[model samples]
Target: MKKILFSLFLLGCSASFAHAHMFWVNVFESDAHQPPHAMVSMGWGHTLPMDDILTDPNSARIGVEKLELYDPALKKTDLIKIKSKITEAEVTNEHFDIFPADLAAQKIALKKDSLPGVYQIGAISKATCYTHYIDNKGRYRIKHKSKDELDNIKEIKGSLKNQSFAKAYITLGKWTNPKPLGHKLEIIPLTDLSNVHVGDMVGVKVLFYGEPQSTSLKNNIYITAGSNTFGLDEGFNLQSFLVEGKAQFRVQSKGQWIINTMKGEDVTKDGKLKDLYGKVDTVYHTASLTFNVK
Candidate 1:
């Protein structure tokens, strides 16, 4: 087995990191074989590769609801049955104020006879609801329940439901155009993954519920990306607003890269939220994609 090393960095106190968390998937080529198989891992936090541990307020592990891999021929392999190796590590660097974290990872072997093309791996997280309000005692409290289920609250600060979707591409022998696997929110790459090089303009499209997200000042999609070597430095990475559901960025360097975006909707008055979870304020939808550039 090949060892995976993670470097921990101090998370910047930005507005995005102050209140938001992201989930993404990382695909690594295994070093244990000649034609390396793919190794999949889940990342949760603001930074790339690794950051804060994934857990609820009660310390319960938060895991993906679905994990699947698609072959070049579109054959699906369910990876939910594979037992993941969960590991934990404590961040004790005095230079950086951080907390302990956990990682869930697994290795998967690809089909030897599969077609030589791009393979896709995707994951979806279970939806969870949280409510922030002031209790009758004049104290602020955050509960992992809908406002309708909480009692004795003096003021309802906010409430929201969050879920995430992630996808990564790996090329075996040759490059092939990959199709979206029907994620609620997905990032589809218009540029070839296997042949991406520095100075190449890469294009991508953002889709919501299988429809293109039209560009608008109030609802335009925001896309961000960073290289594994540089890390995710606020205001220093690639940031762009999608135009008519499409965005493009120039490759700056050669290395592994991750691109991600998020969309939040005010669904407090929506009929769907009223029927599913009463008194919900917002619904957050996030998506990410990882690939390597030469």
Candidate 2:
């Protein structure tokens, strides 16, 4: 049976793979055939990955609401807008056999330059959403179709905290600000972002609303690259708390690295980020940075 409302299933889609927020920045000029611009993307239902976005841009959450470019000095944040697309792929429907089983989202296109120093870019998406899900019995608890699956849905009610996501970082040659971009809860590098090496102890500090607040993060913080996630629920890979507000760790693998805080609070009543339905009194903040070691 064709889904009466295709979007209802979206709210309950599987997200067991998303360990952290990830945004990928691809320098277009890296390939001789590619342009000199940049493309940023995110992924959903999975850990947001850099390489995956290159092959499957549709893995994200459907929009590139904000893409900002910051120079080494952290002087300016230039906003760039990209397109959003929702796509469906035919994966497997052995159980839910009436609709497209796989879904993805993608966004693209931002400007890049030839500046030799370090640079920082951020990609963010926002949404006012409502969801209702019904779980089925046995064999992993599948979901069954319902006549009212698309109707009489209740709005998700809870805390009023909005959510913001960031992805990607890199330090090459010498000079990128690993400092916080002022997200509600952010991770900034006290260690130079532009000079990290394989064995270097890259210093980091957690800030809550622009103030140092690493003590609260305690065991709640996490770091990952590829499928490996460090701390709590697992084990602290190489992480150490230097003080109440700073933590330091080393990267083991090469390629791209992502540093992030676990779901944290966003306590700001600036009145700028109101929810679509009404006022959100509190918000959850997750920050991620993807950079390369090689």
Q: Whole-model lDDT, candidate 1?
A: 0.70
lDDT of 2 by residue, 53-139 (tens): 212222224345666766656666655454343333446465742223221222222234444455566665553222223323211
Q: For all the candidates, what are their Cα RMSDs to the real structure?
A: 6.8, 8.5
In candidate 2, what residue range of length 10 has the lowest lDDT sum?
A: 138-147
Clash pairs, candidate 1, are: none
TM-score of each: 0.80, 0.56
Candidate 1 lDDT, 1-294, residue by residue in tens: 000100011021111322245677878775477556887777776566776556533322345788888988889987742232343334546585444444447776766675788888888887767677778998776666778899999998767666789898778887777888999889999988777888898889999899888656678467877775554645346777787788988888877777877777666445555564466777777788887777
